[model samples]
Target: MRHIGKLLLLTSLLTSSLAFGQITADPEERGERGAQDPLRSRTPEGNPLPFMQRLRFGGGISGLSIGNPFSIGVSPVVAYQASERAVLGVGVNYVYTRLKLYDSAGQRYNFTANQYGGRVFGMYEIVPKIIPNLYAHGELESISVQDNYSGAGLPVNRTWIASPLVGVTYSQRIGRLAGINLSALYNLNYTTSSTQVYGSPWVLRISFF
Candidate 1:
């Protein structure tokens, strides 16, 4: 009878020990399993912001021109992604130039030069993440020259240059939705040199979009 009582007590103790062991080990084992899982969240840190909430803005502040004389330029831009791969924006540009030369006498003369413009641009990515990334680009630009440069020889104070450009763009994404843009484009309006905005038909631009 004493042996039977001892066996009963031992079994009860063993059951209680097993229950306690499970209660203690279950949490640690679950934690380890959670650590192994890639999508499990063990800590309080949350994910990044949503893509729509990620609005980006960028512009150019300085530029240098290399030609007959030394010139400098600056352009500013603002844009928002209209779709998954389309962006629409506007920008403003300003350029300044200076030249010092003398003709007959040894005197010094300073000349003023400038080219200012505003841009309305759109970019749609056709083939993304590949070689020769194709983008459909379009812009309507209004440029203004200084009053001194505007005479019978040149047009007027302001000139509008419109073009539908298609080209290859290379971009590097820094975070979720923000990135830098570098594009080499050809102007489709290759009618005459008088209608062109920049010097050449092929234009290269760097921006943050």
Candidate 2:
């Protein structure tokens, strides 16, 4: 009788284990018991589309340097992305320069110049996040010079020149709509008729736009 009772208890325990396994193995019950996953419900390959894939604009100004016949100008720029790694931009600048000429016995004269330009450029990002950007541009400038001396009777002259630019710019991305950029450019061609100033026409550019 005791052996028979033991057999009956083993049979009951086996039946209970089988019932528990069946309940746990149900697809709906297993799903309910599974842990929540935040990233699992995303689109198939896990890359949703960006709000704007390829459009940007920026602009800024530089400090003034009128002495040494050197001056500063403000430049405003706008761009459109042609591809993932290339961008095309256009810019405008308004500039002024002044020279103070003084002779023996404190005789003094002031000369002023006004210039403006429009530029179109292209940028290629080879190493988008690691180094400075490589760029090239062309500019058309309208220049005028006048003497401010009361009796000098200096002629006011105006002319236009085309300047080619090649440079590298370092950019720090601040956010979706902001960045800091610093650059240096060598002006390719400044004809003798453009300006009779002594300094090289290279421009050092800086901006936050």
Candidate 3:
């Protein structure tokens, strides 16, 4: 919940800053609703594209599954354009994990857990290169897992995990408005809870807007 609050506040600040910049009249750029704005969009004499006209929608997937203990998990994100080079998004994370054990006599013991969580994230392009655009990224995630036990009268065990990361992404543009990215991030909250079925703090993304 604390992480949720932090994410909301960060998102609000980012949007508010962009909004303020857009609404404030700039000496060089056309106003948002000004007729000159469209004039600037003309091919030969155009300024950069309008902000709203550049809005993009896209998503990406990340995760892995293992065979031995029968563990599987996935993390997916849905993103929206926040500015010319910035994006904000949400994600759903889910995983199924199991463990098996046997006693000396021949009895078997098995345990399982179902884990699920939510994530909020932001990405901003810091250097606009032709290929392998560089962007800064950050995200907050929360997840929970409850253990499954076979015995009656056993207390249910549940654990919650929070992951926070900040990193950089290198991407090659697919076109004017799309790209494929490979990212390397360092986890700010690197606890046992922040660990993942796949490598933690590193990610790959495909997006368009």
Candidate 4:
């Protein structure tokens, strides 16, 4: 009876030790378990987020009416979140521009042209924890425009122009899955000799996603 009693006490001690070890597991082990927990997988709208909630769509539009030249354009983008801090996207743009010009004899005339283009872009979050929604943006664009250097006077020929742009953006969340972003970019390929589509190297843009 004495030996049986000792055996039972030893068994109880072993079970208690095992339970205590499980209850007080290492913090890293607990974190790993928490990360895998399905109960914590939720979207901002309180719905269950899928394994890859990465695709996003956004775009911007601009209209300008200043006397000599008037222009209107639309840009639409489709993006994918590559990681926690990186995003990649592609976009298409169309602009209609009307210009008032003078001939060599000083006669005023109105000219209308259409500009169309496509771009691929990438963005990276800058110090996400410290700077919050700030991001660095880069893009490569190819546009079809009238060749102004082709003997001028209505530009009989069309050409493709390539522009490389770099900038920074500030993002603001408007809803659970929607956001607005403002970016100030500089064109790296801007030159006086080339057919300047944008007129300047600086571009300010506002977009929604």
lDDT tens digits by residue: candidate 1, 19-122: 10000113453475553212111212333324434345565432243553344444556665554466677877655555456758887665555667787877
TM-score of predicted structure 4: 0.66
Task: Output the lDDT of residue 205, model 4.
Answer: 70
Query: lDDT tens digits, residues 1-209, model 2?
Result: 34334434543443232210000123442355352211211222444323243334456653244455555556566655554345566777655554567889798666556566677777666663344343443333333333232234666655555666666766554533345666676667755543432135666666543
lDDT by residue for model 4 (1-209), tens: 34334433543443232210001123453365452212213443444445345556667752223344555556677766565467688888765566667879999776666677899999898985478668999998888886552224553567788889899988775534556778888889887622235545766776665
After superposition, candidate 4 runs with Cα above 4 Å error: 1-52, 62-70, 102-107, 148-155, 193-196
Expressed as tens digits, the lDDT of each residue in 48-157 for candidate 3 is: 54565443334333433344344444444455555546767787766555556678998877655557888888888796533325779888877775544334237767
Clashing pairs in 4: none
Could you tell me the TM-score of candidate 2? 0.61
Write down the TM-score of every candidate: 0.54, 0.61, 0.54, 0.66
- Of candidates 4 and 2, the better by TM-score: 4
Candidate 3 TM-score, true structure as reference: 0.54
Off by over 4 Å in 2: 1-53, 62-66, 129-152, 191-199
Span of ten consecutive residues with least summed lDDT in model 2 = 16-25
